[model samples]
Target chain A: MKVKEIMTKDLTAAEPTMTVRELIELFYQSGLSSVPVVNEEGRIVGIISERDIIEGALPGYFEVLYGITDMNHLSQKLREIEHDRIEFYMTPEVIKIEEDEDDLTAADLMIRKNVKSLPVVNKDGILVGMLRRIDLLKDLL
Target chain B: MIITVTPNPAIDKIYWIEQLCLDAGELPVMRATRSYLTAGGKGINVSIFLARMGIENIAMGFIAGETGRAVERRVRDEGITTSFIWVEGETRTNVTLLERGHEQRPIQITEQGPTVPPDALKRLLIHYKRALNRARYVFLGGSLPPGVPTQFYQELTHIAHQHHVPVIVNAAGEALAHALLEKPWLVKPDTRQHTEIAGASLKTPREILAAGKEWTARGIEAVLVSHHITHDLLITCEGAWDLEARDVQFQNLLGAEDALIAGVLSATVQGASLLEAARFGMAAATASAESEELVVTDRTAIERVLPKIHIEQLL
Candidate 1:
C-alpha cells in the first residue's frame, strides 16, 4: 500500500486571514481539531490546531475577565479581538509529504517525528490530500 | 451537549464500479461508476449518525478552500447543524472504489492533506474550550494535521478534564497511546490498532480482552475493541463483555466503526447501561455491514439486530 492508497483526498482547509471567531465556528461545525492552512494557489503553507486558538486567546481573555467590567469598554475590546487574523498565531514551520511517497515511508516519517498527520502536495506544491495516522492504521488492517 | 472534532474532513467520493483495470500507457478506467460526496471524517460521521438517531451534538473542526466550503454546504444541506474553523488550505478529497460485480472488494485511495499551521491549531484548541464550556461529552476523533504534535489529543483530553467534560478518543498509535494518560472516558481501538498499541501479535480473544482490561485499569473508563472478523468487546469499569452479532447478509463494511461509536455514544447520552450501549453499538455495526452506503442504521434495523446480538460477561 502507498500513501495515496489510504490518504484522505477530499479535504476541509483553512485560510490565513480568517478571523478567530470564524475559525472557532468552523471548528464547531466541522468537528476537527486542526485545519490545513493554504494560500490562494491551494498550496500547503501552514496548519492551525485547536491549541493555537486557545493559547492565543488566553491573554486577551484574562484581560477581559480580570481587567475590565464596564459593558461599553468590554464591547470595544471585543471589536479589537474580532479583527484578529489567523496569521497572527499560525505556526510557520510546516512538515509535509509529497503525494507519490510510499505508504511505509509516510508511516515511517510520522513515527519518527511523532506527528499525527502530514500534508500531501503535488509537484507544484499544491495541496492535495492528508495522510493521517488513523488512515495509516486503517490501511495496515 | 456533545462536541466532536474533525480537523481534516472530506467530501467522500465513493465509486461503485464493475471492475477496475490499469494498463501501461492506458488511463486506469472504472466501469459503471457511481459517485456521492458525503460529509467525511470520523468525528463528522459520528455526529451525523448520532443526529440521525436523534442525538443532539455539535460537529466542530476546520474547513478551508473551495472543497471546505462545499463540505460545509453539503453538511448543512443534510440538515445536520455544524460549526467549523475556517482556514487557508483546501479540504481534502477521499476516494473509495467498490468492485461490485467482480469480487465484491473495495480499493480506497486517500490524498495527503493540506498543512495546518501552529496558530490554526491553537485557535482550534481555544474553540474547543469554548465548546467545552457548554458540552458534557467531547469526542476527539480523526488524525491530527501537519504542524500539530501527536499529543494533540492528549492535550485536548487534559483541557476537557479542566472543564469537567468526559472525553472519548478514537485514534491509533502514538496519538492514542499518549492520550491514555489523561484517562479519557472511552477509547475505541480496532483489533489491529490494539495489536500495534500493545506491540504484540494477539491471537486469541482472551489476549485481546486482557489488553482491554489493562487499559481500563490504567484509567481509561472503557476500552472498546472492534474486531476485524469477530465480535466487538466492551471493557468498562465493571468488567469485560463480548457483544457478538449474528451473521447477516453483508454489503459494505466502510463506516461501520464510526456507526458503532455513534451508537454507543447515543445510548450512553441517554443514560443507557454499558451493556445496553454495547448492544446498540453491535447492532449499528451489523446494520452498517448490511447497507451498501454509509448511511446510519435506521431505528428498525438497529432494534431488529439488538435482540440478535449476544452479550457475554467476562468477569
Candidate 2:
C-alpha cells in the first residue's frame, strides 16, 4: 500500500502568513492540531503543530532550564505571541513523504523523525495529502 | 437590507479537550469538556454580525442535507433572515479541537462542502435577484462549492451592480481575483489572500499601499486589507488610511473580519464618511475579538475601543 492509499486527501492547508490567532480559529473550527504550511507555489514549507504554538507562547529554553515558574507571566507571554505569524513558530524542517511512497516507507519515516504526521507531496513537491502514523498501521492491519 | 451570500456553508463544531495525546499504533481518544455548534460560512458570519448590530440583513446561500437544515434553522433562530437553496449532498462539518486553557493552540479540520448542482445554483441566483433587489449592500463571501465556476462571484457582482446594490466581497484565490474585475464596492482580503492576489509577500505598509493602488486601478472602489487583526488598511480612490489599536487578548478570532465588515456597513448606512466608517469597523473588530462568540455586538465594549483607535491617513 502507498501513502496516498491511506492518507487523508481533503486537507485544510495553512498559509505562512496566517497569524497565531487565525491558526487557533482554524484549529477550533477544523479540529486539527497540526497543519502543513504551504506557500504560494503549493509547496509545503513547514509544519505547525499545537505543541509548536504552545512552546512559542511559553518561556524560552533558558527560562525552563533555570526553573522559573510563574503562571500569570506565562499566560501573559502566550497572549503576546498570539498575533505573530505561524512561520515565526512553525517547524520549517519538515519530514515529508511522497504520495506514491510505500506504507513501510511512511512508517519508517515517522519512526525515524519522531513526527506524528508526514505531509505527502507529489512529484512537484505540492502537498496532496497527509499520512498519519495510524494511517500506515491501519493499512497494515 | 444587507444580503450576504455563502455558496458553501457548514456547521462549525468546536471541541474543548483537556489534553491531546497521539500514540503510534493506537487510536487517539480524547474527551471534550465543552463543545459548540454554530452555523458557519463567510457570508453567514457577515449576516450574523450585521444582525447583532441591529441591522436588517438576509443570509442567502446553498445549504444541503441535514446539516444545511440545521444551519438555516440556527441562523433564523438568531433573528436573521435566511434564504438558502436546498441542494443534494450533506453540508460539510468543520471540526476544531481546542485544548483546555488558552495555552494550547487549536487544531482545525475542514471538510469539503457539498457539491451544488446546476439547478441549485440557478435557484440561488434567482433568490439573489429578489434579495439583491431589496439589498442596500450585497456581501458575496467564502469559497464556492465544487461544481461552481471560479467566476461565480464576478457574475453575482455584475448582477448586484445592475440592481444598483453595492457589493462587498471577502474571498480568496481565483474567486477574489476574478471579482476584482467587476469593481465591487469593497473587498476585504486578509494577509494571505492579499499575498495570493499580489503574488508577492507584503511585509510593510508601502508594499500594501502599492498593491492597493494596483487593485484600485482595476476600478475596485475600496480595498480593505486586514493584517491579522493587528492593523486594518483601507485604500480608496480618495485616500488611504491605516488604523491600529492596542491588541486585546482575543477569546476567539473568528468573525473579527466580519465584525469589521458589519461595523463599516452599519456606519456607512448611517451616512458616516469613509474615515468614520473605518474607525467603527476597527472598534467593532476589537469588540468581537474580546468575546468568544463568533460576532460581538456589545456596543459598550465597541465604544470603549473606539476612542483608542489610532488612524493615520495617507493622502
Instruction: Return the top candidate by lDDT.
Output: 2
- DockQ metric for all predictions: 0.03, 0.01
- lDDT (Cα, tens digit) per residue for candidate 1, span B1-315: 688888778878887776666663467756656766687888888888876777667677777777887877676544454556666677888888877753235677776566777767876775566556567898888866666688888999999999899999988777887888798999886444346664633346787788777888787889887664438888877888888877766677678888888888888999998778878887887788778768555888888877768888888
In model 2, what lDDT does residue B148 have?
A: 89
- Report the error of model 1 at residue B96, Å: 0.4
Q: Which candidate gets the maximum TM-score versus the true structure?
A: 1
Position A56, candidate 1: lDDT? 74
Per-prediction TM-score = 0.68, 0.65
Locate the minimum summed-lDDT window of 10 residues in model 1 chain B.
B193-202
Model 2, B154-266: lDDT tens digits are 99999999989989998887888788889998888755434667373455778778878888877888888877456888899888988987857666666677788878888
- Compared with the true structure, all predictions reach lDDT values of 0.75, 0.78
Task: For residues A1-141, write the lDDT of model 1, one tens digit per residue.
Answer: 766557765345677888877777667755667877877556767888876775575546654565445667545644566668888877767788888889989988998988899988767786656788988987888
- What's the lDDT for candidate 2? 0.78
Error of 2 at B81 (Å): 1.9
Q: What is the lDDT of residue B211 in candidate 2?
A: 79
